[model samples]
Target: MAGVVKTGILGLDAMLNGGIPEKNQIVLAGGPGAGKTLLSFEFLYRNAKQGNNSVMFVVEEEAEKVLENAKGAFSGLKDIDDLVKNGSLSVEGLSAVSNASESMRQSSYEFGNFISDIEAIIADKKATRVVIDSTAVLEILVKDPLMFRKSMLALVVDLRRLGVTSILTAEMSSLEKQSLSFRPEFFLFDGIIMLYLSGEEEKRMQSMEIIKMRGSKHSFVTTPYDISPAGFKVFAAEEITQE
Candidate 1:
């Protein structure tokens, strides 16, 4: 009861002062290979071990490939695969290529059905933690901004009704400033975690910042982080000491 749900990432919970709040939607934003997907997977995977069921819905990747890639990131992730086999955890991936080929056009009902499917899985798995890897694909799926916003609102509201603490991964632009590729999705969520990749050409480094966290005291500094065989590890960027 004290700990809502822990992400189990090194130094991350330390910075958050605990973990993400339950029954709230938090956006995880980053560019390609910036460790957004890994962070989401790790959070859900860790939840499964803590007796809290978890679910993941990937809109741009294959379900099998997602699990395979996750296995490589965290050796302990073998347990995640086991949960899938044992039906303790549920995972789904709706790739742009596949979903587009099947649906032909993006409609509210199609998006509604996706939300229904996710809801069913949450109930079936008794999931308390949910992750949607990369909502950026929504831009391509729903062409109209208003339509996209409506679809996202419906989805988020339904997820909240299920009493799930959800984390959605979004792909941010490479530019220094924030881009408005999927701005509508941000307004519906309760929190935002921004992953920043800074430095010139060859010396680029990844940093994590809790941009907006509703009803919580969050970190303001951009802390450094890395992905390894274990999972994502956040660290304070060390100053280069010069004599």
Candidate 2:
């Protein structure tokens, strides 16, 4: 059996038949307000609390904003600031690299440099878990779909080589129409977790499903979940009914 890295989200581990396979790259797919960021944050925060070092690469939002939002969203996870300050957790923004490479000048060079920097940080910190908030930013940088797929595959391979379990977030236009036919990342990733927001406006609800998980048996049911002050709470036994 492959080694596992506990997600720390309540009830999620049991659904995964234990936890995510060590060194596997999983994609957290969802639309806006689906709790992708919160879930990923909780994964890292929980791991850090267990004496594991983690690094979060913020691409869609500013690092400071991500940290601030995490504090409010996960009030039950104490000492978040201290954990970051003490180097047990690290949150970094990709804005600098994005801005510097904006002219499309030497795109490959800039991208390679950024990857090198990430690898260096992982090594320096001995981080066991990593999160890349929104791989959508890479779509803007890479332009060509085929090239983006190649780049993404390379990045995942690198993360695996570094021996760190990683979560890469991706935005979907609509959860109802999601299909793996055209998404190369879906094929490359070791697992895919899709988050959903059902109902209308005021009555909206959030849920998640394990679409695919390699090397392990996982619950395929759409499980109801909530983003509370403590972080992600997955109701593994309760299914989200379409009313």
Candidate 3:
């Protein structure tokens, strides 16, 4: 049996019947302002706090901007700077060389130098948890659907082979259209967690649901969640009712 890694988010682990299985590559899917980034950061933060080293690869946003946003969004999360300085948490932005250089950016084959850099970080940091914030940009990188599928599958397989629990964030336009057939990643990952933000103005609410989790039982009901100074607070026991 595979080991489980605690996400450390309040009320979330119980929903997973303990925690996500170790080395499982999961996709965090949601629209804008769905707290995807926050959840990913909190996952790494909590784990690193417990002495588990982690690495975060910022694909869309810069590393410094991510840290600043986290500070503002999760004010209660103190000592983030200290954690980074102490080497408990490492955050890096996608390398420009890997993205721009022809030699590093392969046209038809593989994920080139970008993936190589991530592997290097994992080994150097001895990281057990990894997060790739937003794979939407990656879609742009590959351009071709077939290539994207192949590249992503290879990436997922490589990450799991590294023996680290990984979260790869993806952007979705709507929660109503929940279909795995739309994207190749939905099938490649071992688990899928969907975050949602719906309703109008004042009535708008946030919720999360576990779409699928291989090798472990998980709650299927959509649970409401909040993004406050403390980070993501999931109400797993309370099922969300659309108003």
| Candidate with more favorable, higher TM-score: 1 or 3 | 3
Candidate 1 lDDT score at position 24: 81
Tens digit per residue, CA lDDT, model 1, 20-40: 877888999877767888889
Q: Which tens-of-lDDT digit does each residue in 73-98 have in candidate 2? A: 88887899989988888887765444
Q: List the candidates ranked by lDDT, beginning with the highest.
A: 3, 2, 1
Question: Positional deviation of 90 in candidate 3, in angstroms?
Answer: 1.5
Model 3 lDDT-worst window of ten = 96-105
Clashing pairs in 3: none
Residue-level lDDT of model 3, residues 63-126, one tens digit each, is: 8899899989989989888899999987877553244334424554246556776788789889
For the record, the alpha-carbon RMSD of candidate 2 to the native fold, in angstroms, is: 3.4
What ranges in model 3 sit over 4 Å off? 96-110, 175-182, 238-243
lDDT of 2: 0.82
TM-score of each: 0.85, 0.90, 0.90
lDDT of each: 0.75, 0.82, 0.82
Question: What TM value does model 3 have?
Answer: 0.90
